[model samples]
Target chain A: MPKSVMHATRAGQPLQPVGRRRFLQVASVATASTALLISGCNKDDDTPSAATVDLGSGDVGVLNYAYALEQLEAAFYAQIIATPYTGISAEEQAYFTSIAKHEAIHRDFFKAAITAAAPGNIIGSLTPDFSSVTFTDRSSVLSTAKTFEDLGVAAYNGAGKLLKNTDYLLLAGKIVSVEARHAAVIRDLINNGDFAADDVVDASTGLDKAMSVDEVLMAAQAFIKEKITATNVGK
Target chain B: MNLFHLISQVEKLDPQAMDQLVSRRNIFTQLAGMSKKAALVAAPLLIGSAFNQVLAGNKDVPAVFNYALLLEYLEEDFYLQALAKPGLIPTGAPMNAIMQIKKHESAHVALLKGALGGAANPRPSSFNFGAAFDNYPTFLAFAQALEDTGVRAYKGKAGEIKEAGNPNDYLTVALQIHSVEARHAAHIRMMRRGAAGGGIMQAGWISNAEANGAPQVVYGPGNPATTFPSEGNTTQAGLNLVTALGTTYTAAEVSEAFDEALDEATVRSIAGPFIVA
Candidate 1:
């Protein structure tokens, strides 16, 4: 559940695939010097220098960022359910189990989408650290869930503009709605109807929170062990 | 509203006369967009023409805005009606939270109206705004469906909305409102659980297609067919979820992983019943 994937380059392609002359150039290089390039294109060669996780720029980076957040959520929910938070009801247990399943589904969806879209360029799964979370306490679990869910929504919101491809944008839109749904549920679980509470939505504007990749990563980095960076995102 | 619907409304006008009401160029531009990019190669110029047509006493670009404005009016009015009725909202957190929701919807209505100015479609004379009973369970049940529908509806037509000049501004506003609708869906679903005497809580997202044995139900039998078909769909960009990710996730989990967009037609149909005479 703590798994994080790191990919090279950015998120999915936004514009139509670089067509015509660019495509021919890439095609020629591929077929012209097959063996030497093939031999050089091994897994070891693909890792970014210094091994720091770089979510590639543009749409792919956004997808990677989303994949990382979903992984964190899946892991957190799994832990709470596995240990069973103190005094957790059978009902609450069932509810969180559903949440855990949903996060896992989301995590796997991104993994599958990224891999299908970028193949070798896809990020590798990441490992997470949860030392600070008090798994035995209901308060801690729900609060953490709230944080993850809200962060997920904000990340998706902020990343929407970065996509040049409407398809990727639409796909991200699909997931962000679910994340918002999760955020509201977790908030209500902690305190009913605090779903779009003042903290998350600006009282004056009434718009829901949206955080840039850098802002979301600041809160996300502590729970994740990877040396993640997002400067190239949307670039 | 969509182009075909708008076109059908203007069928009686002669070409030259209609040009005075709504530009022929702008209508074709909107039609090009609605036809899913048949003429998209001319996008920048098409959009420029569209933008100019809107500003030049035509309701072309504003037609799409009016669609959004109309929906916001529907939602704001629905919430206000619910709040007016006693016993629909339970006391304390749920009620207060819903009140905030109503306010946000109202703000959305106002925001769109301000953006549209004179071009905004007037609100329908009245809305149905119900799944019948005035009890909390009934109110929340309808609220969940409405909000969920709103999310899909926005996503479905976002491409259409993006055509009204600035792609950046239209998309940003649509997404902002989309997430809020999702939040509302979740909270209402959560409250409905309490009203129904909770067992295991439903996942905040729709878990599966109603056709494929989704564990939880979303819309009732009466909702238009497109509503559930879209929600239950698990395909994206020609990739089927279960086929692509089946090894790791169960079929249900695979379905839960992605939300689907309804076509503009489906969106109009979904909102059809709620538009009371």
Candidate 2:
């Protein structure tokens, strides 16, 4: 059994949204070949870099997987609201605010739960690279939002069965359905009536998408500033 | 989704059930070995694959499976009837989507039936789907209620399935169904939002509180809807969303954050009118 560990960012300023809420720290780094120094479990390298982050294993790993995604979601929505997209109505602003706040709470809730469950195992604040996402445009913002929201719904669906504890499964269930709601809303915003379009929900199966850890992490790597390994989750 | 019932049943009789693929012939052979009381006790254990897995679990696992089967029957029948009615559904995207939904429900019915073998509960004798909305306006509102109720109904029973534990391969499949149900619910909301009188557009997600004019949104005659109230409930696991989530969150966000769960009793009532005697 490997000891639960988060190698790089210990007391490293966790990612925080700019303005309004205080106490969050933003990091800088992007587009490098990955390094997962999850090894050297006992070794202490005084200097920390953005190269590698191992979410740990068992339930801790599952929690970290969720936390990483939440961090990404929180950052994504934060960027959207910070600079409102053009043609953004007052109604749109309020809706986006609601989305941002929910993601933040989701990010923080996992952080709090993991800290209580395993003090040092929680992953640090994730960096966001929204370079390609034009925050000034509603189409760009909504498209990005649609991707993140659908990815979240699929991630939870994939991860649920791996959970051993019923409490954790139930919690994941509670959150995932909400994610499904978010995905549906975003999809509708993009195209009037394609909320559960055949792309995400299979035509034959009548089932929504569920991605394996590798599949989810692969799709997620685009916006995320750091490399992640979800393959070992719950192993 | 209720794997516990199936797994424990398997633990007691695996190789026998395994050799058969929930084979009816083998299952019946074993059924003959037991006395009347024993057979009664073992009935739930006899499920070849997915069973009722309904909320308000019955120790008799078959009962749970039957409940789920009944739900599929209702959804499948309702959609099929709507698509069949003239001018009831708009001809384009709405019709196309409802057709897809009906197709899925039919698939669900087939899957559940195959899983149950000979034990599958037949669809209730006759079902009343309320006034067939000849127009998209009435239809979308009706669709929203049915889809919303379906999502809640599945969720309400999920815990029991979770508790049933492993080889509960049924749980995974059931969850697949549950998530899709949610998407179905969302799609309906999306269409309603675009409707002329649809005030729900600004509110695509199910809120912590039901919308002010939500009562009129429900479908199915005679089913006093208790499921919608909980849709807006803000407190979860004893934590009040408004107080605990900080001031930045407006009441709406808090409302949107968590979807409410329906218990079996409430779901049954919601489905009662639709399931004719």
Candidates' DockQ values?
0.40, 0.37
Q: Count the backbone clashes (under 3 Å) in each candidate.
A: 17, 13
The sequence of per-residue lDDT tens digits that candidate 1 reaches over residues B156-227 is 656554443333255666677788888887777666656546522465777665421111333322134443
**How high is the lDDT of residue B267 in model 1?**
59
Index of the highest-lDDT prediction: 1
iRMSD per model?
1.9, 2.0
Runs in model 1 lying further than 4 Å from the true structure: A1-51, B1-61, B130-135, B162-168, B196-203, B210-229
DockQ result, candidate 2:
0.37
| Model 1 lDDT tens row, A171-196 | 88778888888788778878877888
lDDT of each: 0.67, 0.66
Binned by DockQ into CAPRI classes (incorrect, acceptable, medium, high), candidate 1 is acceptable
Candidate 1 chain A worst ten-residue window by lDDT? A1-10
Top-TM-score candidate index: 2
> Native-contact fraction for each model?
0.62, 0.47
In order of appearance, the predictions have TM-scores of 0.73, 0.74
